[model samples]
Target: MTPIIREARAGDRSALIRLMGALNDFETEIEENRADASAAAEHFAWVEGQIEAQGGVMLVAEAQGRVAGFICYTFEEDPGAFVRPEYRRHAMIWDISVDEASRGQGIGQLLLNAAETHAKASGIGEIRLYVLEGNARAQRIYREAGYRNYERLMSKRL
Candidate 1:
């Protein structure tokens, strides 16, 4: 069955948390960061904070009465302190994840499409996001969706 993608509602907190746990698990596996119970709690809190941040978009995909995935995005009036003024007022997709059981079912792409649509409707001309270096699967999806590589983020553990 095709999943329905819609804006996240107040009752979607639990499902959103579950989807984030899956995302955090995959991220922890590829990065040096630790993913413990506390980290999960922190992620939940962070998601909630973003949802509460006005003027942003929070969406979820539901199938068979269960949340299959979610996407969160926010507008950045100033892309960054260093970005030129012309590049400001862009939308950023902060997080997007689908449950493990729902992988390869087009849920991720649907979430992305929804995000782009929302951004355009909101009068935001550009959208951006960061993907983990090791997440080839997600990278492929993003590229296929017409996203181009623009910058790289380097980090050093000291």
Candidate 2:
């Protein structure tokens, strides 16, 4: 399928929310062994607001007249917010999601390539992302795209 990748517009809010909910369900299934559909829906309102705010950039993959995947990120001066400066050479992948039906079609790779191209043109150094410990599939994709595991972070609520 020929996937059209383009910057998301305000009109894509609904589709974006749907894709995010799908990803949330996918993650919940991986970790909690349950689908928290209700919780995902509840968070969509706030997520939509954030996507429409400053510094936010969302890209959507459209195939067959529908949105198949999405990547959302924000450019920031403070690399410390999520990654160390040394690792924040250029950009960060805050979130990337491929709808379950669209997995394995190289859509994720296409998105990453587009992001990398954008970063390179902007003269950024590196692209960084955090993959959950158990998400080997995503890790593999990032690794195949030239990202390395430079650090591991651990946290706990006291």
Candidate 3:
């Protein structure tokens, strides 16, 4: 089914929270990154605040009258504290998730397309996002959607 992509509203909070939980579970399973239920709750709280604050755009893909996926994003600018100003303006995809059952569907792409469209219309120069190191499926989808890795983040446990 062709999912309806729309701006998320207050009425969509519960569905969004459910999707967030699913995303957290998937990520935790893949990486065991301490993404427990409490972490999901905390993330949901942040999302709820973002929704209420309108600091960003939260969009949801609805199929069969239910939310199948969601994407939250915001426009950001940095003064380039020590670098050139060319690295300043960009759109950041804070989070993107599609339910496990909805995988293989086009919901994720639809959300991404909508976000890119919005970024282009806003005159943003670039769109940025982070994918967990082992998320090859998401990386492939992003690459196919015109995204390329520009940097890598690494850490070491002390």
Find the candidate with the highest lDDT and give its number.
1
Candidate 1 residues 59-85, lDDT tens each?
999999989999998887774578777
User: Which pairs, if any, clash in model 3?
Assistant: none
lDDT of each: 0.84, 0.74, 0.83
Candidate 2 on 1-158: residue-level lDDT in tens? 67999988767767777877777777785676545555655565654456456345578899998888888665445545586765554456677888888999999998888877766676666767778877888888898899998779975656
Error in Å for residue 125 of model 2:
1.9
What CA RMSD would candidate 1 show? 2.0
- List residue ranges in candidate 3 displaced over 4 A: 48-54, 81-83
TM agreement with the true structure for every prediction: 0.90, 0.79, 0.89
| Pick by lDDT: 2 or 3, better one | 3
Lowest lDDT block of 10, candidate 3: 47-56
- lDDT value, residue 142 of candidate 3: 97
Best candidate (score: TM-score): 1
Worst 10 residues of 2 by lDDT: 47-56
lDDT of 3 by residue, 1-158 (tens): 79999998878887887888878877887786547555766797786576456456788999999889999887777664764687677788878989888989888999999998878887877889989888899899999999998779997777
